[model samples]
Target: MIYYQWGYYLTKQQILDLYKTWGGKFGRFNPHDLTDIFHARRSIFHYLMPGPVRVWIAGNDAGDGVLFFVGKPNCPIRESVEPDLAERCLAMFGGPPCPFTLVPNTGGEAYIMKRKGKLYKMDLIQFMQSDTKGDQYPLSLDEILPEQMHLLGL
Candidate 1:
């Protein structure tokens, strides 16, 4: 399984700033270590940085303003690691914490979301279908299951 988190609303400069800061502090391989093919990809920039665990931070030059963290495959990001990372990211980016997940090959993957400083888990597919805009805050696993059960009620 691979763990990841997504964040939005950053300029290309901000992304580069993050890469530099993280690379200097924790990167096992620096930006210069990336292959030419990776550098040639103009839309996205990524660097592999290893702290307590390995992670890749990436962003795009497109106006979408998206940045993401990808943990190395088969390595689960520790619980302590994510909150610390998210806190720092929030301090820098000034937005809601994005969803974090351990994506599995089987179905029913759960996404960890933060609302009002409390964390909640929701099924990945349900979150995508209903909360892509994040209107459904403070959601709970029980809430999702019951709604589906109601739909199937006859």
Candidate 2:
């Protein structure tokens, strides 16, 4: 069971707003998404996030945190978040608009392509360490009580 966390620097309020608007439902790739090279490779990439919301204190106690959810809602698969930590992670884009993308298994881990056909990739470790302000590790399920796991639909 592979799970992914799409990292984003969003406020706590913004997170709540997203839940209210999207009903906690995250996004999946659509046909139009293929134009983006990063998204074009995988049709079901978003399904990788199936764990609880992983949060890391970033710059402040509240309002700022490196937060993201796991897999898709009602996902039948279950896996400890530990292995994902050891697995490859997401990378921040150098340009504006889309700031992040999943680091591919081979080649450069970070990528950016210009409208004019230019493309680039960056070091995965450096990006995660510096761009994120600090390393953000995945949250583990072992700490959660078995009875409460269902609340997260895990």
Candidate 3:
């Protein structure tokens, strides 16, 4: 089964303060969104982040750890924090070009792929491989894991 860790750091009150001050660079800031934005964004992206506060899990790629502070209402760090992290997060999980697109065929079933007018129904790595060198390789049941399939809502 596909398992992932989800977590959060700061308290709801702290997140609200950050949203009130720096959420614009996090993307947008609406007074009504002090509670909704983080969860809504997580749902759309399918990333189970550990926070409405500050923390990272499967999807955070900044490499440099993220640290959030309960700064004064309009501190310089607060202004810079979300935007910089937004750019970093976007570039890491997001891909080249859009910096926020679903990178195709990454460690999961791609279903189908298009290339040069032909369709690739298997993973490119699997397709390019040949058994000419050996034939004793064991098979994996990755193709029919029921729990994994259920995750796709199939």
Candidate 4:
């Protein structure tokens, strides 16, 4: 099975605010029921009440805050839910920044970033694999935006 996961990195306060605002709407089991899950300094994953689309929030290794949202490939949630949530977060918390996705089993990876008020999408593996240099693959992530670097856990 192929799974597509993507999210934005956020600050701790932002995560908390998100939980407070949207947690209740997640259906049946309140993610808040898990005591201290959000408060912990380390990474944590809180699986929200499941439905047609599965959603969860987890702290990134960087520990700045958390990486949120993940959905299956071709899931309508990507078009319907993700953009709306991203826009809301961007308006409320300053960014819907560094949106990225890694599709397991498919070698698919990409990130969307804002530069000079314009958004650009870059396909990492594709760029790295490009034959621009006589079979010499790109040796670094230097070409990638700073916000996008974290997607590789760098």
How displaced is residue 131 in candidate 4, in Å? 42
Report the lDDT tens digits of candidate 3 across residue range 83-150: 54444434433421110112353664222322335432322112111113221222234432454455
Highest-lDDT candidate: 4
Rank order by TM-score, top first?
4, 1, 2, 3
TM-score between model 1 and native: 0.25
Residue 85, candidate 1: C-alpha displacement in angstroms: 2.8
lDDT of 3: 0.28
Clash totals for all candidate models: 0, 5, 2, 0
- True-vs-predicted CA distance for residue 21, candidate 2, Å: 1.1
Give per-residue lDDT, candidate 3, residue 73. Answer: 20
List the candidates' TM-scores in order. 0.25, 0.24, 0.18, 0.30
- By lDDT, highest first, what's the ranking? 4, 1, 2, 3
- Output the TM-score of candidate 2: 0.24
CA lDDT of each prediction against the hidden true structure? 0.35, 0.31, 0.28, 0.37
Of 2 and 3, the candidate ranking higher by TM-score: 2
Give the number of colliding residue pairs in candidate 4: 0
Per-residue lDDT for 48-73 in model 2, tens only? 23323333223223223223322332
Write down the worst ten-residue block by lDDT for model 1.
126-135
